[model samples]
Target: MKDRIIDCLAYEGKVSIKCMSSTEIVEEARKIHGLSPTATAALGRLLTITSIMGYELKEKDGNLTNQIKGDGPIGILTAVADSNGNVKGYVGNNTVDIPLKENGKLDVGTAVGKKGMLYIVKDLGIGKPYVGMTPIVSGEIAEDFTNYFATSEQTPTVIALGVLVDKDGVRTAGGYKLSLMPDATEDIISTIEQQISKIEPISKMLDENKTLEEIAKLVTGDENIQVLETINPEFKCNCSREKCEKGLIAVGKTELEAMINEEEKIEIVCNFCNSKHIFTKEDLQNLVDKI
Candidate 1:
């Protein structure tokens, strides 16, 4: 199915929830970055959360960035998203693999490492960007973001991310985030607490062909969940040869001239989507002339 993000309210509209089915987006990342099973899970989870956070921004031009640096084999994980839920990301090492956990699932925590930090930067087309950070509680993306919400943003949130990678590819990948508003009552909160304890992983439910509304009701324990909006999320990169020209010009005329004398051409590859933008000798000389 196509990727989707659903916004909803439950418990008498006192709680906010975001649910995403990111199978297609995650699979695209796996193909772009050539990620292994473990790296696919890590980047997939990070990308989904980044998209949700991006969609939360109010401005059309706003953006959100998340960086997770852990002391594990997967290295650093970076994801960025725009207000329209266009997400893209890359991993430090895309081929990381490890033994499965005792639970017979991918060992995401061990692959991500327990020591590191989660840094989130939100540029909402405002005077200044907002930055929040917190120590990583677990390299598992969900728990780390959960800690970030409580410690950095001071919002109590429950986050669950999961990716099921079979031999064919990412069979399923998705996640959910639920946050309580200040006005939420005790009974509503307790009801959610009870339901979350018994719910399956988000990816598992998606793999079973569960709809976003069904998952929302299942998690919030409120059958009358209010659906607010539906959004399509995808892996997208905004890079072009024109942007590369600006980057080359920023190096100044002298640097551009030197580049022309020393090399046949320069290639700018986007880290997010792996698209190549090559600047030939003629292009370099033209840039120097513009200076």
Candidate 2:
């Protein structure tokens, strides 16, 4: 199935929510990074959450980057998303593994570590983009995001994120975010909390092939939901040879001359995608002349 994100308004506009399914995007990460089940879950949740946040700023042509730095084997996981529903991410330690929790689920908490900081940077193509951060609440992304919403963004939110991976690849990966607007009533907040308390793991819902509408109904009940938009999401890298060349040129003529003297060709590999770019001495000379 194609990956997509859906936006909805609930409780007669008292609350707004976004849900995204990113199985294909997450699968790409799995294949590229060779992630274990726990690592896949960690990276997938970041991608899904970042995608939804990206959609929230669609009008501004902004991009959102979600980063988690922790004291666990994974080290750090970073996901970047654009308004167009494109996402790409990587974890510092893709092969890290830990024992399952007492409930027999992936020990995401332990694998991610209990101590860390979640940093969010938004680039809105304006004077200065905003940045907010909060300490990790549980190392389970949902709770950490919820904490970030409350502390960093000053919005009360409920976030549910999950991913299930196996030996083959990511089987299911997605998340949901429900946020209460400033004008939301106490009754509406209470009702939403009640619903959230009974919510199931998002990965399980996706694994069952639940639609975005169905997931919304599960949280907001059958009554007050207005589906706003649905957008397909994917793993997309914006890196290109031209961009790399621009970066190389920015390194100045001295650096290029040194590189040219030391090696016949300078090979540059993109960290986001594994594509390599090779520049010969002639290429370096051209770049230097252009400067």
Candidate 3:
């Protein structure tokens, strides 16, 4: 199925919820990064939520970035997303394989490490970007973001992220972000809490072919929810040779001359997409002249 992100309001528009199915996006990351099962689960969960949050950006040129730095084997995980919810990400270590929990689930918390920080940076193409950060409550991506929203953003929110990796690749991957409006009633909040406790996991629901709209209803216990918008999220990288050339220009003329003298050709690889850009001696000389 195609990746989708649906925005809705439940409880008579007192609560806002966003649901996303990100199987294809996660699978694409797996193939691009050659991630192990544990690594896939870690990065997949982050990418899922990143796409949803990216869709929330208002400006056409706005973008969001998520950074997870932990003391685990995976080191640092980074995901960048645009206003349309198209995202690209990379893991510091893609071959990390750890033992599963007794419940037979991927030990993402252990793989991601508990002692770390979650950073959220937003550039809305305006005066200054907004940066919020919080310590990792649990290296399980969802809980950490929940804490971030509560502590840093000062919003009462609930987040669920899951990724199921089979022998082939990501079998299922998805997430949801739900927030209570200021005018939300106590009774409605209680009902939604109960509903959230009873529903199946986001991954299981997506694997069962449950649509994002259905999942929104299931989580909010509001059959009469209002669908605000539907968006198609994608795993895309904006890296290009021109961007790489700009990066090389910033390295200073002296450094460029040294690189040109040492090697006949230089290569720059994008961390997010692993795309390579080669610069020959002539190319280096031209850039040096420009500087």
The candidate that wins on lDDT is 3
Models ranked on lDDT? 3, 1, 2
RMSD per candidate (Å) reads 0.9, 1.4, 0.9
Q: What TM-score does each of the candidates earn?
A: 0.98, 0.95, 0.98
How many steric overlaps does candidate 1 have? Answer: 0
Residue 217 shift from truth in candidate 3, angstroms = 0.6
CA error at residue 203 for candidate 3, angstroms:
0.6
Tens-digit lDDT track of model 3 for 143-245: 9999999998889999999999999899999999999999999999999889999999999998898888899999999999999899888999999988888
lDDT of all predictions, in order shown? 0.92, 0.86, 0.94
Residue-level lDDT tens digits of model 2 in 123-152: 987768788999998898889999999987
Cα lDDT for residue 253, candidate 1: 90
Clashing pairs in 2: none
- Which runs in model 3 stand beyond 4 Å of their true positions? none
Better of 2 and 3 by TM-score: 3
Give the distance in Å from residue 178's predicted Cα in candidate 2 to where it truly belongs.
0.2
